[model samples]
Target: MRFMKSFFLTTFNNHLIAYPTPINIHYAWSFGFLSLMCLTLQTVTGIFLAMHYTPHIALAFSSVEHTMRDVNFGWLTRYTHANGASMFFMVAYIHIFRGLYFGSYTKPKQWVWLVGIFIFTLMIMTAFMGYVLPWGQMSLWGATVMTNLVSALPMIGDYMVFWLWGGFSVDNATLNRFFSLHYTLPFVITATSLVHITLTHQEGSGNPLGIDSYSDKVNLYPYFVVKDTYGLFIFTFLFSVFLFFYPNLLGHSDNYVEANPMVTPNHIVPEWYFLPFYAILRSVPHKLWGVIAMLSSIIILSFIPWLHSTETRSSRFRPIYKIFYWTLVFCCLLLGWIGGMPVEEPYITMGQVLSVYYFSYFLTTLPMLGTVENNLMNYFNK
Candidate 1:
């Protein structure tokens, strides 16, 4: 027993507790831990919800309604799972934005950042699939609408759509596949998260000052571990507020109605987390280009580490980057606002323009800044 304790201590102490980390990292650092906690909450709650859920089109909506009305504490479980998803995305976006502002995606940590992006992509897929399992009006039509995007793929469009739907439309087979994938992907995400955390541990944490931590390293135990715990508590309190008080606040009213093939909602808005990308999709005039642009919005993010180059690591040190960094942030928030609005007139025009600025910031602004900044840094050093 003593030997086993020693072995456990050695592994954890060396790999995690004794791991050297930047001392000055602020509350932003805590969001990573908060995100993991949210995912955990989601997974547990989802498992319970799934046990009672029926993936069949005929039974799916009624099954969820039964779970809410009949099973002991079913409403609580359902609300927790639904709200937990929102909280997870909320925590994740904050984590991503924080990394972006501090240049955490730069060299050495690029692979780690990539892992983070992969996890985010998996989360999105998992969420989209899970949304369909409830089998509501929004679920049926949303699946049909989104899957129909494949029809824009030129000659092979119908074939792809047939495969995606398992037939001509969103039916039983589609729901079954969605449930299977939705139930499975969270565990995959959890496993990927372990890799992400391991890579993060190898490099230690980055900071706002953006300097190397070797000069002022501190162990993860007591300080960082405790700090992360406190952060989790804060997140939990806020999450509980949503679960208990306002369960449907983030959900669309259209989703509560049973799906009807002939009926369509006046407006088909996605969940809040996906709104920005949805806006981007509608921004383009053409179908294929719209899908490409929407996808590029996310795919482009992974290339950011290579897209920009500079000697300095943090935006705090780069005056020009700091300005554009905030511009990117504002653009994302504006896109979210535009996403929730009807895609007509002034809103459509505004979305298209914002989409242009969004891509330019990544393609044009960052690369040019990197070249200019690298030269400026070199001239000063000499």
Candidate 2:
């Protein structure tokens, strides 16, 4: 035990003494630490909820209610776990945006950022499937509708949907499988977290300068560790408040009731985190095309490193990159907003336009910016 303690202490000391990090990382950088804090909170609260959660369809709904009303602090467990999902997504989005703003996805750390994106995608899947476990109206139909999307494929799509459901429809087998996957995916994500952190330490954190091995870089300890701790405190404070008081704030009222296959939800919006990509799916006029576009939106994010061309790390020095960056951000927001509205001709048209811009930003605009910036830099040098 002494040896273990000493090893940790020494490791902490080494990281603390490493270097001086840039002071310009901004509040955006706080999100990564906040996300870590949120993960812990979610894990703890989730474990408690699991103790009272019933996996069987017959008892799952009542089991949740039992915990909420009967078990000691069961309500707290329920609310915290539910609300924490929202908090997790909130911090994750900020983390991803911070990476984008600082070019943290560039070489050396590309795999780290890619892992982060993978975690993000997995998180969405986990949350989506987990939300269905309560056996609520939205939970049932939402699972049904979303899973049925897999059937949109030509040959394997129907088979895939059937496989996911474990039956012809969203029934007992489906719940059991979703529950199993939901329980398992977090561990997978935890492993991915290790990869993310290892890669992060290898490349070191991206400073506001976005350059590698710059004199401005700082050690992970006293500086960021301290700053990260502060963010954790803030996150903890808010999370505690939710756990104690407003735990259900992030959940839908319909989820409290048992799932009724006969009753379809009027407006079945998935949890907020899935809104943007879900919107992208709803935007397409063609069934297959919608699925393709929605999936492309996610997979395309990984290609950003190859696409973005500016020689500089930070967008601060690249005027064109900054323009394109903000444009992409706006387009994403637009896509998200359109995703919630009723599917219509105009909305579909708008989604297509934004989708075009979205891909263009990756495939065309970023490359163009790099080339244009290179030319300008050369001209100035000459």
Query: Model 1: which ten-residue window has the lowest total lDDT?
Result: 209-218
* Model 1 clashing residue pairs (backbone): none
Q: What are the root-mean-square deviations of the candidates from the true structure over C-alphas?
A: 1.8, 2.4
lDDT of 1 at 198: 87
Best-performing candidate as measured by lDDT: 1
TM-score of 2: 0.92
User: After superposition, which runs of candidate 2 have C-alpha atoms over 4 Å from their true positions?
Assistant: 1-12, 15-24, 237-249
What's the true lDDT of residue 12 in model 1? 90
* Cα lDDT of model 1 by residue, 14-69, tens digit: 87678888888989989999988888888999999998999999999999999999
Q: If scored against the real structure, what TM-score would every candidate get?
A: 0.96, 0.92
lDDT of 1 at 329: 89
Candidate 2, lDDT over the whole model: 0.81
